[model samples]
Target: MRRHLDRIDQLILAELRHNARIPVAALGDRVNLSRNAVRQRIERLERDEYIQGYTIVEHTAEARANVTANLFVYRTDRMRGGEVIAALKSVPEVVICDVMSGEFDLFVRLEAPSVDRVRAVWQQISMMTGVRDITTTVTLSTVIDRT
Candidate 1:
């Protein structure tokens, strides 16, 4: 079962989403709660898994979302789908591999740490036994991403 969150709890979550390092007193001021009450609620939020953890979002030019690419793969033998997918499972950069219904046999999404790594992932996919042809497109700029 899931726990229910009240309006104040929702407000607390919103503030934390913006700045996870906000102090207890500062958060309390925004949420209209005393310091101790805020601390207790935060503890409860953590214990209940509503507040799982925090992460740093690096804004540096090189630190943006690594490199994302899409690969359209053609296969020589359509019967070898399972073997190709199983091989891709071992490659960490292979984020999404879906069997498609057109000229291409598979549509793949890759997220690598660098452009070179993205090319390497594409090469790896190409070398698979059943793969016949491949077309790759790298993301130049992400206009909007909700994921």
Candidate 2:
């Protein structure tokens, strides 16, 4: 059983995050590990919760058709593996959330059926504990989305 992620394990996870569909052999080559070894480590990472699962992020036509926005959330306190973030996971429209370094502490990307939905999600987010202020920007269109 794997306890901690070593340097090689970290490298494997990093590559997987960039491209989950990458073949195991290709992943191994990038991380300088044998294919079998890489496979074993990935399995262990999943079991140990170092990795949750593989997923694909796409800018599909359906996705692109929706109202997209970035929410810059200012928090009163630093995150503590807290309920605020956990609550965000339940908001279906929120596709991504990040901890930032500057004026804002949390950044969220939300794609909703309409602008109204985006406002509704914002209301819910603003009411959560630790959330002090939120600034939202609607995305007009994607110039280049590599994600």
Top-TM-score structure, candidate number: 1
How many clashes does each candidate structure show, in the order listed? 0, 0
- Candidate 1 error regions (>4 Å): 1-7, 39-60
lDDT of 2 by residue, 46-89 (tens): 89988876666755778567999999988888756367788899
Q: What's model 2's lDDT at 73?
A: 88
Candidate 1 has which clashing residue pairs, if any?
none
Instruction: Give per-residue lDDT, candidate 2, residue 81.
Output: 34
Per-residue CA lDDT of candidate 1, range 1-147, in tens? 347999999999999988889998999999999999999988888988998877676778786768989999888887766788888899998889999887888998998899999988888889997788999999998899765
Tell me the whole-model lDDT of each prediction, alpha carbons only. 0.87, 0.87
